[model samples]
Target: MTPFFASAASFVDPLDEVSAQMHDVTSKPLRDIVVAGERLVAVGDNGLIIYSDDHGQTWLQAAVPVSTDLNAVFFSDPLKGWAVGHGAAILHSTDGGKSWVRQLDGRTLEALFVDYFEHRSGLDTERAQSYLSALLSMTRPGPGQFFMGVWFDKAGTNGYAVGPFGLILGTQDGGKTWQPGNTSIDNDDLLHLTGVRQIEGALYITGERGRVWHLDQSSKRFVMGEVGYDGTLFGITGRDSTLLAYGLRGHVFRSIDAGRSWASVSNDFAAGITAGTAVDGSGLVLVSQAAQVAISRDEGTTFELLDVPRPTLYTGVVSMTGGQLAMVGLNGVTTLQIQ
Candidate 1:
């Protein structure tokens, strides 16, 4: 049964109250969207969660417990799913996205980080100061908690959630418990982490100032890799050995040798590429903040433009049934078929 859930807004601290009912909720601000088997789920501002089982022809709101802005969402399958956003909120849904329960929130996450880092600092005095510094600034108890990206494995056993200030959390037992990454990340500057994704079996994090970090399997530590740009990279997507990292001011870089070396791929028209995905294995679709769409037929080698019916700031996108796409942005959900 679909509970009479609120629209996107109606709360005290956003975490203090459940969403309330509102009309035309699908037109509210949305940030991210993903495809879960036949259903398409989209989340955005004011804790909005809407899903469509019929290729986005219609929408239905989920019973969400909090009203905080949801930043990213992922589903390991059609049933088990997760969404992370502001206030250190991580939500899980057992039966698709019909209903959700809070897994982690600001109330409990602060102390968990303190305990983990304090213990870690005691074991390694050389990095103790670093850990302590991070403990105070990164894990401070308060209402401001933002997790920008999240992803889980196919079996829904292991997952990672990333956020601002170099914060990363991992869960092994299906999100029963989550822990701070064990090893110190190479981001000494503690740049804000924008996204967490897997590329060719390697876990990578994209962040500020064109910084990209990949976990070293042997050391289990994240280390920096250059993608030949110095602007904030919003995200990355690729197929096989070809990778594309895009960001501010219409800049995009491609790494053909598995990130060993990168060359310029940016063009004059592209501007602030925000969300991207690989479709049909070979085709790539990328959308920018300028409401522009670029399609790459041959991996990330080159791109061509596509027209949008109405231009708006596009934040996230996912391929839809047939040759269409379901995208979420400032004005809400917009579905367009590839032409």
Candidate 2:
């Protein structure tokens, strides 16, 4: 019999290279940031994952198993977390952000998706065929697609990951297995699903063409929840009944009914709002790619401009203890003592 180590080294994907251990990781270009209890966790290009226990004062690199460009990171709780990235990679961590093991990658995800849909019934012919074609095409020599966002419940037993072309996957057994939920979604045009988050008591999925898909409790399917905008929504944020849909060109819409309906609560900034975090359900802070900050104290009903001090192509932000925030993007991590 072949040795265990020898068998494992039989094949490898180029993008599956492990992340490098580097000094001063804060100088790296990070893509997403999240607050994990008292520590702050961040992920970025080339499968980089780092954590800071002293609230972004200094950083420690984690042992990441892939070199893919991680686009988003989410923590269900302080100790359980997950990160998604290019190549359809999904990574899980049980000890906060200290380390990660590859849970799903393109190779495994391709087979899982194809098999799930092939056996699924009652799905439209076109959607099923579309998914199969994409899967086949992406199964080529490289990481063909990305899973942009990931989220899990507090119990860490349920979660979903979303990406372009209406792609969404859910796992009930804590990501031990995932099912393709894209076909069940009412996205006829195959709109790219950019973000997914549970606002209040409802699960909301955002995507291109100003579309919002809400999980129907009875039907267990995603149905359209229109917000009446024509641009792409990058993400959704809120706590309680209040929700905010962030889109291109600094456009933000507010929903007080768990995303059932929205009203124009635009922030008159010209740059794209990339990331935001709620301040204990009472307020929100948004960051733009053009180094701008918008703060709202009245549950996203109105907003006021704040300062970012340094210009960075901001992509993610999280609320920390006290009146402070941690942001990550092209310029790595920056902590602001928001007042």
Candidate 3:
């Protein structure tokens, strides 16, 4: 969810009541979409989570407990999933995408960070104080906090959610508990962490100023991998050994050796790339905020622009069943077929 200004003393319940009745939200703003088993789950503003089982021809609303806008969602499996968004809220669901329960929120998040920094080990007094101060300023018990991206491992045992000002939270036991993960990363500037993905055998995070980080196995921490452009990177996706990081002003870069190096890839549009995903057998797809679509048939080596039926600000894209694509954004969900 986007930021909303409010008094520091003002308090908004993160678990605000949401309606249970179903409504036609197909044309509402949607931020992210994912495939959970055979169901297509899309989330957006007003705590909306809509699912479709028939290739996005029709949609059904899910039961969400909070009214805050949900920015990102991920399913460890068809049966277990989580959604995070404004007010620093984390919602969990066990039955596909039918219903969700509040797991954590801004109030709890503030406490968690304060405790972590106050009791953290191996930090110099000045550095620990600096970290604690930053966390206190960022997690100020309010509703403006936002989570931009989320990803889970194959076995659903580990997961991560990242967002504004280098906010990173990790869960080792299926989101039952979350711990601050920013201490391990090398984000001194505290830039906004936009996306997280587990590709190949490691986890990669993209953030502001073209910063990319990979989880170091030996150190058990996230280390800076490489920098390609000076602009912000919105998202990253990979297929096999090839990876793509895309962001501000149509910038896109590819790395084949797991973030060791990168090469700039030419893009047709000047608008920023907001989302990307790997197709099962067709290659990679990247969508921009200008509603432009690009297809890379050679594992992101090269891309060609594709025509969009209805141009709108696209926030997320996912490859669907039968070589189809489902996109969600300001104008809601749209399905595209590629040959």
Give TM per candidate.
Answer: 0.91, 0.89, 0.92
Model 1 lDDT tens row, 1-339 = 534454323326788767665578778889999988899999988888999988887899999999999999999999999999999899999899989999888788777776766674355765755665665575563468689999898899898888877777888888888877635478766677899878777777899878888877798788888777778888888877778888888788888776667787856545788988877643788888888888888777789988887678899988865678788888888887787
CA shift at 165, candidate 1, in angstroms?
1.1
The lDDT leader among the candidates is 3
Q: What lDDT would each prediction earn against the true structure?
A: 0.82, 0.83, 0.86
Those runs of model 2 whose alpha carbons end farther than 4 Å from true positions after fitting are 1-14, 120-142
Identify the candidate with maximal TM-score: 3
Instruction: Give every collision pair in model 2.
Output: 165-192
Name the better of 2 and 3 by lDDT: 3
Question: Which ranges of candidate 1 are over 4 A from the true structure?
Answer: 1-11, 120-122, 138-141, 182-184
lDDT of 3 by residue, 28-102 (tens): 899999999999999999889999999899999999998888999999799788898988888888898999998
Better candidate by lDDT, 1 or 3: 3
- Write the number of the candidate with greater TM-score, choosing between 2 and 3: 3
